[model samples]
Target chain A: MALTFKPLADRVVIEPVAAETKTASGIYIPDSAKEKPQQGKVIAVGKGTKEHDMTVAEGDMVLYGKFSGTELKLDGKDYLIMRETEILGIL
Target chain B: MALTFKPLADRVVIEPVAAETKTASGIYIPDSAKEKPQQGKVIAVGKGTKEHDMTVAEGDMVLYGKFSGTELKLDGKDYLIMRETEILGIL
Candidate 1:
């Protein structure tokens, strides 16, 4: 389903990438050891706030803090809603 | 000593109020059960950003999130430095 939800202020909606399940050396990582994913694809962005402009565009891959943003569910898919400042950088 | 530190952007420097050591009924509270103080007096304010103007001023007693802002020390006194957005309200 297409996302019709628009964020407010400088908020953005993001679809998180799954955490890594394997090591570079080919070792399988257990679910208990998997860290929260910090990377995601921007799906929607809010209009810039009075003092700042939106920096990431939809379809941009971005990195954020491990604990940033609020968890959301839309159209049965998991997403994150956070301010643009929460995004560390575009990848 | 007077505070000479100036915050940047929308950041503000605050002097936190000490946590309550007694209940409203005057019962002594233990250290382990004391909540972190979420109130502070604004010490210095930034000139704001390109998109937003600062909403607070020096000497304003404001409420904020318990975990918001960065802990800082200046001239042997503890302080918190945070963006104006982190301030929830002025009291």
Candidate 2:
């Protein structure tokens, strides 16, 4: 879904992949025990500075650092705002 | 000074610039009140993954986010380990 947010300067808005609700053994994972997901889909990207090139594009799936990015809630949906460098690999 | 630590894959080692001890208006800033410095000089860098290009090099002064990176101490000096993407700009 598209929104009205616009990031600035190599920053990106990412929608994280949801954590697994159940294990392969059919045990329900409690919310407190759910791991933070490290994968996401790029939603928005900022224009890169003159010194740096922006390579990530919208709709790209990416891997990021475990603690990278700031969490935000927009329109009741969660998103992360991080520099493009915080992305480890483009999947 | 050189060290033996080598970072892995898109990570970088940085020596943070010292926080200002005094304000420009002649007010002495105590250690507890010192702001986290957001600038540093790159000391080491990891080889980037095949998808991400490694563009930063040692000795390049850079600006980073206030809360970015992990703190470490080597040879009695402090350093930070962060991905190259945590860097906001190269100075």
Candidate 3:
């Protein structure tokens, strides 16, 4: 529960909840896998830009496209959150 | 290899490559199953605007955050491609 975002304009900042490599299911694939699964926790959300209005909020777990978001480094780790358009859905 | 994009000044259109339910792997979970994987193909790309530039081209398989990109419905199909920032990494 450690997340906060300061979005500029219509860009929403989200702190992706890191997916557990090994869930209760079984051993999760390594990052080396070509077709890997993406998981994350949301931290910050941006205001809607242009014609897009945001429906997601902070602290909401979400799932987005693997190819979405600009890779960002915060607090010496990885985190990503872009425009409301970039976000897919809340988990 | 089937993609065409008509981005509107700073936006890109992508045709998500639908992920195979049953791959060379084992049984793929049903959509009703939580923690599902998202897959799509790139179709269109928008021209750069403001402070962003066009990087990812059409037909390039990409991975994004689950909460990334605005969900769009076009021609009875679903697709999304925003700024280069919206795109996480090329797959």
Candidate 4:
């Protein structure tokens, strides 16, 4: 499935990875205690502005700040719309 | 006074602009109803990483998302530490 919405400027569309429910020590974390997920896969990219070149591309897994981006529901799935700058690094 | 706290990779320091207590029509807005300010002056910028070049400089006024950055008290004043990408535009 593809997104019909296209981002503008330096914005990007990302599908967030799910938060882990279990710890390394085998402790199961409840939903309320789970940390916000900060990793995602890039789904779409905007045309970069003249001064700022776009650095991220489609299908790149990336790390972002905990509170970064606007949340949205598209096609029954959660996504984030954020600037390319909000992406901490490509993994 | 200069801030001794230098930001690291892709981070920036900003001094937020105060929220206006009055509207353009001269209506007074109470503190409880005021929206968070999204504009600020860039106080410092981190050195750019190999893939991302630093674009902001000290003393530039910038726009950021309302929920962006971590708030901190440095030298008895308020400041926000956010990634350079958190900055929306330079003014």
How large a fraction of the reference contact set does each model reproduce?
A: 0.05, 0.00, 0.00, 0.00
User: If scored against the real structure, what TM-score would every candidate get?
Assistant: 0.44, 0.45, 0.40, 0.46
Q: Write the per-residue lDDT of candidate 1 for residues B34-58, one digit (tens) a residue.
A: 4433777898887776767999999
Please give the lDDT score at residue B9 for candidate 3: 46
Residue pairs that clash (backbone atoms under 3 angstroms), model 4: none
Task: List DockQ, one per candidate, in order.
Answer: 0.04, 0.03, 0.04, 0.03
Error of 1 at A19 (Å): 2.6
* Model no. 2, DockQ: 0.03
* After superposition, candidate 1 runs with Cα above 4 Å error: A21-37, B1-91
User: What are the runs in model 2 whose C-alpha is more than 4 Å off?
Assistant: A1-91, B21-37
- lDDT per residue (tens digit) for residues A35-66 in model 4: 44476789878777666789998988777877
Where does model 4 exceed 4 Å of error?
Answer: A1-91, B21-37
**Model 1 chain A: worst 10 consecutive residues (lDDT sum):** A21-30
Scoring only the second chain, what is candidate 2's TM-score? 0.78
TM-score of candidate 3 to 2 decimals: 0.40
> Cα deviation of B37 in candidate 3 (Å)?
21
Whole-model lDDT per candidate = 0.70, 0.69, 0.55, 0.69
Lowest summed-lDDT stretch of 10 residues in model 4 chain B?
B21-30
Across B13-90, the per-residue lDDT of candidate 3 in tens digits comes to: 666654554434343435563445454456776556556667777667665555565554443355664555767666
- DockQ for model 3 equals 0.04
Q: What DockQ number belongs to candidate 1?
A: 0.04
